[model samples]
Target: MFLPDAAATALLADALATTQPDLAVVHLHGDLGAGKSTLARAWLRALGVSGPVRSPTYTLVERYPLASGGEALHLDLYRIGDAGELEFLGLDDADARLWLVEWPERGLGALPVPDLEVHLGVEGDGRSCRLAFRGVAGESWLAALDERRRLRMLPEPSP
Candidate 1:
């Protein structure tokens, strides 16, 4: 999908937040300034995170306690030199309900397999996002999102 601006990105994030399951792993693929952190922040906000949402570029991972009584882990592996470095992050001990990972390729072997992958690229002054599913969970979520989009596109009934 083509996200013309930050508002469009937030809309997509809202859809995902509302339709997401209790447990999910989402990989955000993009380059510098490609809006990966923007989307992730929007998603977190949509999921009821009211506090600051910072990028994990230097810290590696940022954990948020959601209002829904679950945790969301956002990881930025751009600076990771080796996949083995993930072991030191203690990701296996985390009990987060959602995982939003940027630069997932850098932690390929150590990271959990993504249920859904959002690929973003710069297009004009906006960003283009492509959603790809890796399993049944992701497929179901995408189907719900598609249905939501379809419903929104429908014309309103006349009074």
Candidate 2:
């Protein structure tokens, strides 16, 4: 479904804050400067992460300890040249962690399968996002975000 930039960002933050599930790994797929990192920053801010929050395009992973209560891991793989590098980062079996990864396709063949896929891309005024849940938990998580799955049929307000 499509959500305005603010709404989409809020939906993601709400999903993470409300559910409080064991693990949730979201992958943001899109081109460069397509709002992937923007989404990540919004999410981290919603989680009450203080101090400067920058893209992990260079160091790969940015770990944050939520001021209130939570933990988050954000990763950017756009600079990585090989999938094997993910293994070196020990992202192979991150079983119970909240991770937001960008440029996932670069490490698709190596990284762990995402629980949720938030597809973001350029649009007229704001980027469009498609949220897809992969595993059972993720499906349930999405259901909780959208109780009746009503957002799909609703027409977005024209900008």
Count of clashing pairs, candidate 2: 0
Give lDDT for model 2: 0.74
Relative to the true structure, how large is the alpha-carbon lDDT of every model? 0.88, 0.74
- The TM-score of predicted model 2 comes to 0.81
Q: Which stretches of candidate 2 lie over 4 Å from their true place?
A: 6-8, 67-70, 90-96, 148-155
Residue 24 lDDT (model 2): 75
Q: Tell me each candidate's TM-score.
A: 0.92, 0.81
**62-150, model 2: which lDDT tens digit per residue?**
88876654568899999999878887776554443578899888887776678888888877667777778888878878777677443
**Residue 86 displacement in candidate 2 (angstroms):** 1.5
RMSD of each: 4.3, 3.3
Q: How close is candidate 1 to the true structure, as a TM-score?
A: 0.92
For residue 45, give model 1's deviation from the true position in Å.
0.2
Write down the worst ten-residue block by lDDT for model 1: 150-159
Model 2, residue 148: C-alpha shift (Å): 9.2
